[model samples]
Target chain A: MSEDITLSLDDAQALSLDVLQHNGFSRAHAEAITRSVMAAQRDECHSHGLYRLIGCVHTALNGGIDTQTEPEIVDKAPSVVIADARQGCSLLAFEKGSALLVEKAKRTGIAALGITHCFHFSALWPEVEALSSQGVVAIAMTPTHAFVAPAGGQRPLLGTNPIAFSWPRPDGTPYTFDFATSEVARGEIELHRRAGKTIPDHWAMDANGEPTTDPTAALAGAMRTFGGYKGSALSTMIELLAGPLIGEVLGHETQAAGPESTAKPFHGELIIALSPHVFLGQDCDHHLQHAETLFEQILGQGARLPSQRRYEARQRSLCDGVTIPQALYEEIRRLGSR
Target chain B: MSEDITLSLDDAQALSLDVLQHNGFSRAHAEAITRSVMAAQRDECHSHGLYRLIGCVHTALNGGIDTQTEPEIVDKAPSVVIADARQGCSLLAFEKGSALLVEKAKRTGIAALGITHCFHFSALWPEVEALSSQGVVAIAMTPTHAFVAPAGGQRPLLGTNPIAFSWPRPDGTPYTFDFATSEVARGEIELHRRAGKTIPDHWAMDANGEPTTDPTAALAGAMRTFGGYKGSALSTMIELLAGPLIGEVLGHETQAAGPESTAKPFHGELIIALSPHVFLGQDCDHHLQHAETLFEQILGQGARLPSQRRYEARQRSLCDGVTIPQALYEEIRRLGSR
Candidate 1:
């Protein structure tokens, strides 16, 4: 069913926060997580937004994620920090890590944070955009359970392994780009499966390394790399950075039926924060100014900043209300009524 | 064509270096560039190997690339360095930059170097492999002249923007992954053009944003991203980091009519050098040990390390020498004879 009702940005966030609190999240943590999820929806990334609430609640109930624990900074240096998420909700952990990096970068001109043992953090753009809004360039990547295959192989050997980067522009519009390295995200595949639709053949391969268009067969198999060998290599690189290099288990060891399984996904996150002034020096301000002029000159009025479209959609959602599908809304209300 | 040559690796390196020296490169620079180029060829990356020498030499002669200029460290801190290549050959600049990053990382646990004003540096894998061999994790990215278009756009507004990473294993094999964000490299299109063959339709788009298999049309139009939006977004992120973030002109501004043109491509490079022990601490050695073992286990004897194939090819070339196509060999001889 199509949308029958809508919720304003504030109302949606408040409702989400209340739901989390009712389900055992602290008020502060609930607010943080709810805000992040709502922002994703407001920005039109519905796949990672309110749609994930049920899964998140299930995870929390099953002890796969913690809602109350806060991230603790265990080690700090001029340009690096080690954060123990302490099994906290990823929203809280990521926010803490981002803040730590921003502070360290203010002094060192660049900073990095190593985060571990955090739950799924939703989409990466919001956090990176937050950093970029403060005139900092941010790069982030994380590892998860295996869902994608290595190049030329049919076995699922890696997660989607998304990476994101955000940069501040002179016009106050941050350029943000975020995506999973897989040809398509696992969420997309799941959605297709739910919709009873066949996926594109190139998106995945069956157990025997044959391309398949049937969602059932694809799910039983493994997702292929985005661009064959290159994508496979990039996925491996992501694993190295967000896995063993960060003192976490690699993806191959983390693949199991669910997070409740004995196998820890051993998820890891790495964030790099950079200040343009650090390297630009005397040319710092001039560079930004010239960049704006050059960007405008080349793009003219037809071009928009990378994330500007999403941000515009978010603004609209805030000004007006966000529409919720009737089915999803009814489902949420039913749970709340119960 | 493959049977005529049988020189050892040393002889190949020496011969290449002598040719470079005779063509005006300084002795040290010649040896360094020659080794970098031949190493790729020996490793079986003919695209970036000696195949590139003719174009590089042409650029140097036409003043499009500097043959004798030295790259200088313009800015340096405990964990960062900004290098000005002064229009030097990228191989020379990249080597110096990698060395400096390694030196700084030894002290700071991690280091980054920003490079600007350099020519194409051949294959990125070689650079990362060099750093990884020294027990460092390396992330390198660079922007080239515009070739690929943004997703949903027809115009070529960004470079292929290759990103590379390398991680060391205790077994002396390094995992290296290097690739462009474009579905296929411009060089591949160039190869097709030279061979009078039709390009793959998925690889590029014509002016109207429709896919095409014509090499000439693809060259005049834009290359598609490796996998639709994901690759496009990644390329954009790279341009932000390696191009504008580093205070260089964006790809569109660097467009020109080849080596004879007075205009210079605004190539930019960023390298992140990391020490695994920094974050992993006491568990570092064990983690790496287990990682290597698990990697071998997963791949079994059938699979090889990411860089092993290339390294083995180089070893073979060293023992059996390299075979060059007669036409290409004659062209090299003609250039040298000039």
Candidate 2:
């Protein structure tokens, strides 16, 4: 069994920062990326926590990421902010443009931020949670390298295409959900492959368009979207909104451009923020509180609210710190040292 | 089997307008409602076609819709347009607000339209299609009466909320899709029940929360969201964005206010528009054409695109007209005479 070691969230972030900087990321990039990594660890989202450092270092080493480029902000219009990540990490781009997005949404009721030319590896929740914490409802989406097939299709022509949403609450954590449009996350299949386990039906297909339980064959073939055609439709919508609408490469284009050795996919992201104060004018507080009833009803019926688990984990991690696999910790420490 | 009759798209719209006017809708409301019904018929989407007139008449007779009230528009913010339907039908409110949404999006890159105090029965594709046709990407969503259970909950606490999206295609009809967030639409189960057939599992649960294949039991109990927790999260998002964010009623609240006889659900609708020209400046044309490659890839792989069927049906309906059951035609004519 792999041993585990404990670390404070702050320590986790510092370690991430050290690794990122050692991998040649600029200060701003390292700081922004560390924030998201720390957030994932704090919420015990293992896939995005310190475990992701290996992929980050690999991407940087393989030239999939530009560690020196700074994001360039463009105030496109009254309610649109565009960030040209200049082929750097998406974290800094989102960080720089989000303030303008919030300002515009506050002034105009809704605003959009488009981040282009970036390598994205983090979950979208942190971006939306940041916006929602500032009292605006937030939506974020991005297209990764094409790895999923469209509904009724044979080949992989769509990305996992993650989408996230955050709704502000009057108190406590905001309601949030971040999910890939694929039936399962691409990482889940990788995990299964590593364990030499069979995947469930409807998760993927073999290259010949045949259903397969073999994780290796599924990865070599195509992932399937959840809910069939409806999920496929959403994945396509993300491809349009975050891809062509922002003048960025689509999923297939990103896939075609990559070396395929590094797991990183360079693409664009779209974030939209809507302000309740701007939408409702004087009734903001009352309306925001009224939304609590719906949440209460969900909890009262034993149905879990999205992000409730994450928030609970966050509370614990804050009070008692977090644990990581000892071997993984050593691996990250070695990367930082390099 | 029922006998069928064919009618041109113009005749269909005229018939819808006549029936709506005879049923007490104002001229603007009648026109707007007729437009949606006509489009549905033209696209061979039978559910939203002339068959919807029955529900409209039923709701109007049951005092669920206020036909005399004109939609009141408010320029709520720089990129926000609010249309108060004053307890009237939603179609007119959306029609009134969409132009402003397009205008704002053209000016500011992104914009939102909120239609409140209305009873919505139409599919959201029409609203999004309208915006997409005006050269922008569009999204539309609304919460209906609570008929769906949250994931893990036995009670129906969320609406079978519908979301729609449209992406501009430059030449032909834009890519469009609108679907209920439920595993299967409520009407699908109702049709199964009326036909004395069993529904598929995963569509709903019995009152005890046990999965069931009985449509009647499901209807009397709770419908499930599509894609499990992911779809549930989306339905909840629609509830929040269209409900409290707009100072409108949530799904359960709408259900609590209504008499059980009418199928109409009074609520709010949200529409968001994003303009590519505003986002990409002078590169709009090149980027839009670039998106065609992605579409080609999907088509090339023999994977069907969203709304391809609708567009094909539209072509046929425009050339060869559309068919409806003679029984339905007679029923609508009878309502018009009334």
Candidate 3:
């Protein structure tokens, strides 16, 4: 087993940036991608952090990602934005369209961004948080490769599609959370199997549609949706909204949609910004304050709001730094040095 | 035991219209409400059908609803509309604003309606179905009297809030579904309890935060969010979006938010319309065709879409007519006679 080694934020970010730049990314692309990796690391989302650096590098080298292309954004209407990522980074598209989106929402109360030809490979919270900071209530969703089965079916037809939502808070960080429509992550089931622990009943199902407590049996089957049919509907909605609405590669933006082929990631993303400034007018402040009241009530009842732990993790990481597997660090170091 | 009596669609609609009118509703209000109740009955959603008419009449008589007032609609911006239901019927507000909402979405690609001082009851699907029929994608949500607790809390903080979403289809009926974020409906628990069967462990929590299988104990406690923290977040987002964004009754419009009063429903609702005709442009037909492809894939997986059963139920009801309790028919007959 590899031991975890601590790295300061600056060193970790610089190392990832160096590795991307060495892989042929321009300075701008390297920097933008590095920032996202660091944010996820700071929040201790190591799966989306430095651990995925090599995969991004591999994709960049294999033409799955355009190393130097910039996103093209067109303001089609007062409240509509059409963004082409040029088969490049989703962050680049978000970077170009976010400002225009914020401006449009502020002017017209709400705006939508249809992002196509993108490759999104990180947590969606950062983009939503960015919009919230601009006093914009935001929602973001993307369709990925399928890992979840729709409810009542044995076949995996829907992606473990995740959605991120944020509401602006004038006093502090935005209340934000991202969650999959699935009952449990694929990694969670694997962990239980490795540990010889019985899985929960609703977590997964065997091939015959019967719930199983054995983690290994569950793995051989399919993951169940979190609330059965309702969660399945939400997942299907995300696929529909993110895929066809943005004009991506059909409704399921994955290689597994038809006969499988070795293909680069082709995903679509959607971002909606609703501005309280233009929409709520004089009542915006009042609404924000009332939101705080609701938060207090939830806290009083011993319920923590979503994203509280993430924010706390980020704060602690700022003081103590990020930790990653020693072998992974060595691999990144060798790539950066090359 | 009450016998089930079958009522033709025309007779059922006329009976409802007569009762509402005799109770003080104007012709327009009576017509709008009768149309909705009949649709729900036709769809075999008996819980939201004639079952809830008595409560509607009770509220109207107690001054909780304004029988004489018409909905007030103000088009505030190119993509924004503010609607005041004026303590009147929700169907009337929907009737007035849906056309305007459709028009605005077609013009701006996306439009939003913030409806205040409304008394929304029954299903939200009809309004969304109306928008979809106009070739617009729609989402609508409203917070009501609190029934479900936040993820970790013992006290209820959110309504069994429902969200409805629909996508337009050129081929047939638009896909639509509305669902509460709660893990299990109260009626589901009651049935299991009456049957002396143990409830699902994740369905509800006892007053002390322990998961319980006893339905009666769970009823004494609080219902769980569908997917734990994620479902809680969706519920909270709905409350924030529907409550304060509409500026209804000084924010957080439900009665449980403050000292209990005999006030009317006082709910705030949010309706958003997105037009594919404007946003998708040349790819509109292509997107719809691709959507059909995705649907075929899911259906081929032996997974039924969310509303398939509801549509099938409607078709059956149209052929066989609606079945209701004999007592309910007598009550409506007496009210109509008065």
Candidate 4:
């Protein structure tokens, strides 16, 4: 590793919070935003870490997102709740919406929350993992900017539209799975761009629907769905579920087309939370334990839980300081110094 | 085009219903079961058509399933309901559950239902398509017997767990998608078995975790998940969301373990139903129209809806009767004679 410098988690959070605050965010809002970024870094999801600060800062400054706004609950029923994000950062909106859904599930055994008009929430796994850690099963989806092409199409028409689902294991660790429906995400394109590298041809298509390997060409063109038509169909479902169903506009760019649109990114989200206790009656915990045991039995010794690798990376980083590239750290210091 | 037999939609439905009734089902139950099966053939989903009859019949006779039972609504709230299938056919359970969800969605604008202890329901698309036709956005998932191996695992720990989602287009056609989470399903295995053909290596792994192309070996082993880890993660989500979270026992062979286990062969389902008007206000229909227009504009003349090919095939089958394999047809006739 390069011997430039390293920051503790606390120091990283403080530096990030200062940058957001200097960029005109309230202290509370800045802390919330910084905490989420730090959490991603701690969990080893570097793509969503400090590397994304510039984009988020630009979004806040360009009026594409509001830093101080809060989400408001618009409607509530036995098992459903609707929230208007009111131009807030999606981290705030998602945290609030998830809490409400958990509360509702506690009462009704299951709950669904629809959130509209929010900015992008970095990395979906953390949100679902938070719910799962609270002893609830959670599923979430959000519509995004159009970057992926539908099956058999040449042009981009659907967003990556990532989905996340998680359930708690008896050991308190959550089995979390989150992914974009595209063959590759825009973040990976940015990574390749930074490295001056080419991508696999199947990852994207040029304007005429021919395969392309150049990262620049792929970014200008369209990303393919993960597994052809199946992934394309899933992206369409996310659009329907997160857009029109949540009263948000379809198509990510169209949602942000006008100045009158909320500073929020105009994306929508749906979260479902379920309580196992209601289903398993007196044997909920035992059932989960048995399920995990069976999973281990089938997997044997060498097997790993889905999130275990990331979790171990996080533990190691906590003991030894996290390593950040000199360029990325210098960029963050420059932003804070500004 | 086959010269053997030609049946209109009505005639096909009548014959199927007659066959079920002759096998001792009540007329209403027979009609429901027949309608589901024939609709699969009508929609060009031949894999789920009359070919599933033998399995269903055997299940009924082996005390493995109850053919005469009816679904019971176990719990109801404004936005959610739970239904117990009472070992009943999933055809009845799914239809009843979907109807209830749609009804609740009409009232509350969004609704969800959990269905448990149900028999196998053939062809998930037809149900979602029906909901979409009624202008309700729908998503459905079901957990079944273990047929898929988890990512990096030697043994199968998950069912194919097909998921379906649908939305209505302004042009009066429903955009529907349905697929099993496996790289290939058991139906494909059976198809290759009937043809005395070798399977693809990537489609399955033997019990020892080695890829194989023999149909019999594939059956003895496990189907691989679609796109490896992504599909396996989805299968895990389905198990947690549709099975364990909904009061059904998870894992394969739970039924064989004992009556105390809630694990039926084909068990849990979770369905979500939504009315666009819930969020879109008065412009809901307009939004759908706009979506259709946007999709058309993006695709121009060459783009096709996801299910358009299947629908076209069904129309062609109506005009020119569907072909049936001579050997399979002879086998069916012999069974009937017995």
What are the fnat scores of the candidates, in the order listed? 0.26, 0.92, 0.71, 0.30
Model 3 chain B: lowest-lDDT 10 consecutive positions: B250-259
State the C-alpha lDDT per candidate. Answer: 0.75, 0.90, 0.82, 0.74
Candidate 4: give the clashing pairs.
none
Clashing residue pairs for model 3: none
Which pairs clash inside model 2?
none
**Which lDDT tens digits does candidate 4 get at residues B118-223?**
7765878887887888788888888777777888886777888899988888775787888888887788997898899999899998878889999888888888
Top candidate, metric lDDT? 2
Error (Å) of candidate 3 at residue B264 is 3.6
User: Which candidate number maximizes DockQ?
Assistant: 2
| lDDT tens readout by residue for model 4, A1-338 | 56545678888787788888888776766776777888788877888887778777777777787777767876556566777777776776666667777877766666778887777758888888888888888888887877788888888778888988888888756788888999877879878978999899999987777899888888888898887777877888877777766667665454442346553456778887778776666878777875675457445824556777788878977987566788788887777754
- Tens digits of per-residue lDDT for model 1 on B184-249? 888899889999999879999887778999999999998988877777777777776777667876
lDDT of 1 by residue, A24-116 (tens): 888767877887889888987888777767766766776666678878875555577777777766677777677768776665566778788
Give the C-alpha miss distance for residue B215 in model 1, angstroms: 1.7
Candidate 1 TM-score, true structure as reference: 0.93
Q: Which candidate, 2 or 3, would have the higher TM-score against the true structure?
A: 2
Q: Rank the candidates by lDDT, best first.
A: 2, 3, 1, 4
Error of 3 at A40 (Å): 0.9
